[model samples]
Target: MPDIALVLLAGAVAGTMNAIGGGGTFVALPALVAAGLPPVAANAASTVALAPGAVASAWVYRRELAPVGETSVSALTAISVTGGALGAVLLLVLPSASFGAAVPWLLAFATLVLAYGRRVSRALSTATGRSAEARMSSRAVLVAQFLLAVYGGYFGGAIGIMLLAVWSIGLGLDTAASNPMRIAQVSAVNLSATALFLVASDALRTPLVVATMLAGGVAGGIAGAHLARRLPARLLRGTILTIAVTMTVLYFLRGTRAG
Candidate 1:
């Protein structure tokens, strides 16, 4: 009962975080691991469970979707789907030991990005002094999206933030204007990964856990989308950063103990 409650709470929190910005994986993945699933299985389950929430958030922002620079939304989504599928396949074929070893570092990297991504984006924009009209070519944006999608599929953490950073740096797009597209791309990546995980991974082994989390995720996602309109961006970002930092530290400690 306690475990079930924990998973449900984690899912709700994760869904809310993702809807607000990103870093949901920092919560969902560790909670599943604590629920006694293997790391790889937990990751697969997390991806599958959170997918619907992402879709819901995207739906809420549907009206605001726009082309990323010169790249059409459809083209970016197609690239995301393809890259995410490849990444999911890589997860399925890779040794579990490799994933276990990488988890801590992955969390650390994601935490760092979530913590300073915006600042870094601003710094880059100032350094480059390139106008949006002179932004990276559409082909370059597509390639960057593909790589980020691959990462999102394998172990998404702050994918939304990363996408925003890339688009900000490459296209000089404001975060407010580009956010709808970020949510849409995240939805694409998670949906693609979920499809592959459902067929090829053991994410469904604990059906009850998955179902509980999925339900919580949907509820939270819907609530979050509405809350996003009222919530201050600073407060939301601070809450997410706190969660990311704590999770990253805990994962590092867990790895140390295992080692």
Candidate 2:
């Protein structure tokens, strides 16, 4: 009962975090691992669990969804699904021990990206002296979207933020308008990978826990959208970052001990 409760709480927190900004993986992955799942399966299961929330958010934003410059939404969606499924397959095939070893580094890198990615984006534009408004070539957008989708499918933490960053710089799109499409793409990538997990991965090993988390995610996502406006965003974001940093440090320490 306690295990189930903890998983549910973690899922809710993760879902809320994702709905507001990003960093759900920092909470979801660790919770699952602590609940006795192997690192790889925990990852796959976490991906599966959070997918529905992404879809639900996308649905809420469906009417406002926009095309990516010259690239059709349909085309981008196809790329997202394909890449996401492939990435999920890769996760299932990788050795569990290997993923465990890499988990700390992965968390560390993701934290850095979450923290400084926006500053880096501005720096890139300054260095290149290219107006952020200049639309990217269609080929470039497609290729970049495809690669990000693959990463999103494999380990989706702050993927929505990354996509938003790309669109902002490459197309000069306002974040407000781009958010609908971002939600849609995040959903597409997640749902595609989720389909693979349901069919092939042992994500059902703890069906009760999975179901609890899934339910909590849906609830949190809905509540989060409402809270995003009412709550103090800086405080919320700072809390999430603190959790992420602590988790990364603990994971690295554990790895050192294991070594």
Tell me, what's the RMSD of every candidate?
2.9, 3.6
lDDT of 1: 0.81
Worst 10 residues of 2 by lDDT: 231-240
Off by over 4 Å in 2: 96-130, 133-135, 174-177, 229-259
Assess the local accuracy of residue 258 in candidate 2 as a C-alpha lDDT between 0 and 100. 88
The local distance difference test score of each candidate is: 0.81, 0.75
- In candidate 2 the C-alpha lDDT for residue 226 amounts to 57
* Clash list (residue pairs), candidate 2: none
lDDT of 2: 0.75
Error of 2 at 79 (Å): 1.4
Kindly give the number of clashing pairs for every candidate.
Answer: 0, 0
Candidate 1 on 1-259: residue-level lDDT in tens? 9989999999998888888777788789888999989989999999999999889988898888889888998999999999898888888887756665676676676667666655666676677785553658999999999998988888786777678667765666665556668888989999999999999999999999998889888877777777775656666556555765776787678778988
